[model samples]
Target chain A: MTGTVWDRGEPRLAGPDTALRAELRTAAQHASGNVPVAVATDTAGQVLEGMRGRAFDSAAVVAVLDGDRLRGLVTLERLLAAPAATPLGEIMDDAPPVVAPSTAQERAAWLAVQHAEPTLAVVDDAGRFAGLVAAPTLLGVLLEEHDEDMARLGGFLGTAATARSSTTEPVLRRLSHRLPWLLLGLAGALLAAVIVGSFEEQLGQEVLIAYFVPGVVYMADAVGTQTEALVIRGLSLGIGVRRIAVREVVTGVLLGAFLGGLALPLVWALWGRADVAVAVALALLAASSIASLIALALPWLFHRFGKDPAFGSGPLATVIQDVLTVAIYLLVATAVVL
Target chain B: MTGTVWDRGEPRLAGPDTALRAELRTAAQHASGNVPVAVATDTAGQVLEGMRGRAFDSAAVVAVLDGDRLRGLVTLERLLAAPAATPLGEIMDDAPPVVAPSTAQERAAWLAVQHAEPTLAVVDDAGRFAGLVAAPTLLGVLLEEHDEDMARLGGFLGTAATARSSTTEPVLRRLSHRLPWLLLGLAGALLAAVIVGSFEEQLGQEVLIAYFVPGVVYMADAVGTQTEALVIRGLSLGIGVRRIAVREVVTGVLLGAFLGGLALPLVWALWGRADVAVAVALALLAASSIASLIALALPWLFHRFGKDPAFGSGPLATVIQDVLTVAIYLLVATAVVL
Candidate 1:
């Protein structure tokens, strides 16, 4: 009778001022309309029953009491739903859910669900009920919140360009969408092979470099990723400062040391030369330590600067780490093997 | 009287039922404290008087209406704050905010706010007022919520490593904690300059390459990120399989076209050389588009494989994008410049 329930499947009230026993009348009206409801107070039960199964007159008054105030609401359905013999002392709720009158319509909708309420009782400074907010208003608010979250994410990444052309594709149609491009990796290696063919004299003299390439590349990547993983996790969790600074840093050092130590023996076995082993060990230790730090720092920086922390996590880290890793490897190779 | 408010400003409901109303007292003895609340019917004046100047009893009850089964609840502080002259009808907020029984205790603490009325109400189905959840219980729940949110974020990111050391300074410790990091893009750029110093010779030989460096690296990064972002967002939001694959791929293609056009002109201006511009333009266009599409595809693959989308977002994007960008650039340069 109040209205349809698109708002959150909750009932609605007219406003703050109903005459005494207003609730009772509201219930009776509903019952006449074929919906049964339990009246809260024993005081209002009889008047509702008196007109049992009959349509309630809107102007008809009913005697009622709920806790301390008198309400003008009365409905036949409410009367039918209540236990016929229950005492008035046993049937009323104490406090009702409410919101401020000035509350945004959208926010009000979310509150109904998050706060788990039916009608949002509007109130004033002294906590007096001013009016009621319907459920549909609250639903609108929830949808708006969702939209805002999406917007922030879109802006942080480059969504506009992506949306424009390949509005249907995943991101952008570039070298990757086609199978021809997948062969590019093979192409790069094939080119590398051709380049080495021209430098056959040098490569033949230093054939061991090939064995070191995979380890060096993989190690650099692993260290970089491990660090990135840590930093991103820290920012998202709101981890305490103490842990981020002290504990996280200590962990990076320990991990670097472990990795450095593990790779030293392998490097020595591969080249069987002290110079090569020392260079590999030193590079591994230094790069691992630095990469871990950068990974952690990058995310923290992004979060601190209001940049997208996720942005700090992936491509940037790899760009800096890989480039540096490759350069470091080349430098050490020059220092030792050359 | 119940306990006073806590530091965080939430009302405190202390141990056990004492000084509570009759319905609450009865439910406590009979319902074994499992029920949500108890109800009673009275005038607004009586309801106010019962709650006036005194805290609601610890064993307070949630309330509902016998009239139309509307819900309302009260709490101890609300009762104490209630004005004697106020009518219950104007203040009865039938639907009190409620939480799941299993909610964290810490979060529950702050959640207990009494706009009006005395006794936090707890209720169950069939429109019955069970018993009060009590302020103290809620406070405990609130504490638990904070911890839970932290743990959940960690799990979502899917890692537990906290960085303990860095190759250089602990960037998060030195900077992130005090403020944000991305805002210092200038500083990040300067730091990048220091990194580039280690490879200045390589950069100077092909200054044209320098102009295209940012454009190339960023474009590849943008493409990869766009793809990942869309796929991840879709999976998280629970998009259908068809929608994700079709929508994301199309989006990537569009994004690539837009970026490629911009990069082509920029590289042409920077290099001022016909062949270099054409080669760089082709490379940028291809890499940008492909990187984005690949990035987009990975998220769906991750979901299909039951891996996290955000997991590989950072390190993976950087590596694939950088390697391809660098290799392509070098190859294209060889094909044209040489």
Candidate 2:
């Protein structure tokens, strides 16, 4: 049981597991390899004496190792409370939460929070103790991830620093960070204009049909935004769109039916045009149902391509939802009013 | 020198500081009063022995107090490293990060992260020691705030739990959380329709004006959404909207001019209608410039009223911006194109 060697170099790998090391950014990258370690057979007093003059990245928890393999973990409090001769093996938590080095940082941090652990242990593919991610590092990661998500969702060009500096940033720098998305949105807006213009003759025949274009487009966009928020957040927490698609789409349709049902009578009462009202209601139902699909699919596609799902929730998704909504609304209106 | 009182009740106040304690929900509410405490003159050996059988909410940092007043702080590692007979005062950090008990939880957490402290000390108004907010509690607070911001920005009725459960929640429960905002959006959309209908005569004369409605509205919404994201995030980090307003509005106006200049020539080339193109470009300029103002103002107002600034970024802001954008676009078109 006293086979542990106090080596500070990288954990010696038993085999080359390239697939597990392929992730460019992972828990291993941020973990510190300088935490305290001891053998299971060491008594509490012995470990404490060993730690006295040694430097460690974190001493909140001590890792018990067999050669290079991680065996168990014991918090400092537990060690200090035990009798001087108590063996670490008898006092250690055998089932401490552990993650592979390849795990995503966000997922690792989430696991630490779930387990209420102050530190996270990274185990390599061969079960060797790699390092520990201390609480401060995890806190920084959570804050950084939150800022990145906000920037992406807010249509910045994937710059987390912008969230803090945008308020004080030079106008030119601010414009540069924000213009790419707005330009793409400009292109999308022009495309929506072209789509709406193709139906100019229909609009000229009965002008009331044009009145609901913004209303229908806004509803679809609103519904899609809610779904995008959910899907993006879910993806970050390791929940895939595939797992949520069925329920979300159902919720979208149900929302559509409810809004459309309310809109039909309300439009009839206010606008005094039954056909136009019917068209608006039908378009609401179709546009909203499709909005959910587009919202779910875009994030899923981005995630599949190894991009942040947050990128899918920006102006790009809104533009897509807007154009489709316009086409669906007009098509429904044309069929109903003509 | 062992004059420390080991009372576990609330810190004995020296005077009534009711004004400082008036906040309904603050750091004091979540702070644990069960943390370890010691006096400056106590020896490290004596303190360690005293902590042997104690049950503390957190022992990561010991609060040094003089009667009820907090004096300094010392980490457990430092205590362990000091010679057994060394006075705690000689080893303690004279300055530790502290917050008034009435401080906002987010701000307190931010300070903790800024100082790289594993724990936060809460000092009551009479300079009395309240307790410590441990690392785990701060982690929980940051995650909760992130969820709440996402839900509010996503238009989910201020429910942070919706972020996690929206994927698995029943359709009815999902709808209940989401529909209130959508319904408000519907009302605003209808109001926009009515506003656009008011310009029906102008639209009938030059039907092209109606084609650019969604384009103008979308661009304004996009711009406003960016500003809202920045301001709301800034507000959470304790930066007031007033501090960000000037630069943000300038950025908005600059964004508008750039987009408007680009659109002018493009719309003219595509539609070949000089007056209609001018109206679209001008409306883009005015709507975007105004979008920044409304976006900045709404969040600031909500924050001033003691509500989360995130509440202002949802459908409520979108609807306001949409209606105003439509009216401005159509009004400009009525003057230029009609």
lDDT of 1 at A67: 28
User: What's the C-alpha lDDT at position A213 in model 2?
Assistant: 93
Model 2 alpha-carbon drift over 4 Å, by segment:
A1-24, A41-43, A83-86, A160-162, B1-25, B39-50, B80-91, B160-162
Candidate 2: tens digits of C-alpha lDDT, residues B1-338: 44242536553333354554453246776677776788999987777667654556677788898887888988876876777788889988878989887777877877788788888898877788888888877877777777777787778878536356766777888899999999999998899889989988888888999889999999999999998888877888788988888888999999999999999999999999999889999999999999999999999998877777889996888899999999999989899987
Q: Which has the greatest lDDT? A: 2
lDDT of 2 by residue, A37-61 (tens): 8889998877766665344667778
**DockQ, Cα level, model 2:** 0.62
Tell me the whole-model lDDT of each prediction, alpha carbons only.
0.40, 0.82
DockQ (0 to 1) for model 1: 0.04
CAPRI class of candidate 2? medium
Candidate 2 displacement at residue B323 in angstroms: 0.8
lDDT of 1 at A139: 31
User: What does candidate 1's lDDT look like per residue over A1-338, in tens digits?
Assistant: 22111111222334453542242122211211111222344443343333232222121112232321323233222222345554433433334444544443433443444444433444444443333433222332332232222222222332233221222443334323432222222223223223323433432454443334324443554555544544543333334233555554565455546555665675566447666666666666666666667767766776566544545655555455545654565466556676
Angstrom error of the Cα, residue B171, model 1: value is: 18
